[model samples]
Target: MRAVPRPAILGSIAAVLFLACVAPEDRGTDATNLRDPWAIRAEPGDPALAAGKEIFASCASCHLADAGGRSDGTIPRLAGQRAEILEWRLRGLQDGSIDLPVMTPFARALTEAEIRQVSAYLASLPRPERIGSASGGVNERGAKLYHDRCRSCHSAEADAVAASNAPRLCGQHEAYLLRRLEDMASGNAGGAGAARAVDPAMEAIAIALSMEDRLRVSRYLARSECD
Candidate 1:
């Protein structure tokens, strides 16, 4: 048998000792941390907001001048979204966890500070009125589904709990919401690193819902009002 070098043997022992010293939470290989540093509020009159508005000019082409997005449900409204959620999504796009062809490039273009600034700016805007055509029928089934499964994280109150990661869904376009549900169910909503942005529980729920149930839930959220 070939003999191991003395230096190599010592190096292996040193490496093992170093790993043992690492804290449990700090030793994990997962790169995605949900409690991120970027999810912070920018107060009114903050310089970040001003710079963000200028930077948002590029986004206006697709999201519209007011960030209301397209009424046809091709785009999603950004106005009044939670700043934390916006920042998280932007970071996910930049890191390749959440991959949207149209959005990834835009997200990658921004620096860390720019991501925070733009998120705060978008969150400050007034949420637009319901922007698309509604299904215009009874949504009791959808409401029940939401109440049973979704309300805990996505509260229906005017002011949802800020600490939760869930984004507000009321008044979102039905088609867009439905498509997202489909994507989540099929495990196509995000990229390889999607575990950071896409909750396993959410994916399970989406998979459990039938096609018609998904549509009904989407319709219910689309017409629902929020503060």
Candidate 2:
């Protein structure tokens, strides 16, 4: 047997020790991939999601390596969310119907195939925990508020009416929907209604909501209802 250099022998021993102590997923990353201080291990591969993985490259830039959203809440969550809903939103984006400036570029940049790929990947990821199921949470006042103020423009299509560009509210997360409502109340959601800033009625809807009233209404909307 040949004698190994002492320093080389010690280095090899150290490398083996590190691997033994490391988790399986932490191997094989390069420096660029390591740029994000928050990189993490994703769940085990789902053979079905292989397609989405390839398509999601564009979105991974903003949504992050993990489906988890950013701290500022600027981007909506896509992971673990309903696939159909995500597809519809993407379709809206691709078709140039949704208004937010930030999203316009993303929609325009992605191809139909790419959209399907990314949307599929996002759908396969897990949903946010804040999206809890609706139970005993209906409030008559909120329902009436939705009907009287919101229904004219929003129309009646499940919890949310997307036909009039009102957006379907069914299956939306309680916390997310509520946060949106709060934003609307405080001049935050930006668009008024339908055609993005054309509906003045949305202001009335926002005004009707007192802090508690808005909350109750939000909870009622969260209480899963049939379209």
Top of the candidates by TM-score: 1
lDDT string, candidate 2, 1-227, tens digits: 13222222111111111001111122332334322211112234744367567555544566555554433434334454434334445554444443445444545555666455554566556545444344355778867766665555444533323223233344444455556556656665544322332233554566667877666655565564432
User: What's the CA error at residue 30 for candidate 1, in Å?
Assistant: 15
Clashes of 1: 0
What's each prediction's TM-score? 0.71, 0.49
Question: Once model 2 is optimally superposed onto the true structure by TM-score, how far is the C-alpha of residue 130 displaced, in angstroms?
Answer: 9.2
Model 2 alpha-carbon drift over 4 Å, by segment? 1-50, 53-99, 117-137, 152-162, 190-199
- lDDT value for candidate 2? 0.44
lDDT of 2 at 185: 60
What is the C-alpha local distance difference test score of each model? 0.60, 0.44
* Tens-digit per-residue lDDT, 99-150, candidate 1: 4444455556667887678778877887775543467685899989988887
RMSD of every candidate to native, in Å, equals 14.0, 18.2
Task: Name the 10 consecutive residues with the lowest summed lDDT in model 2.
Answer: 15-24
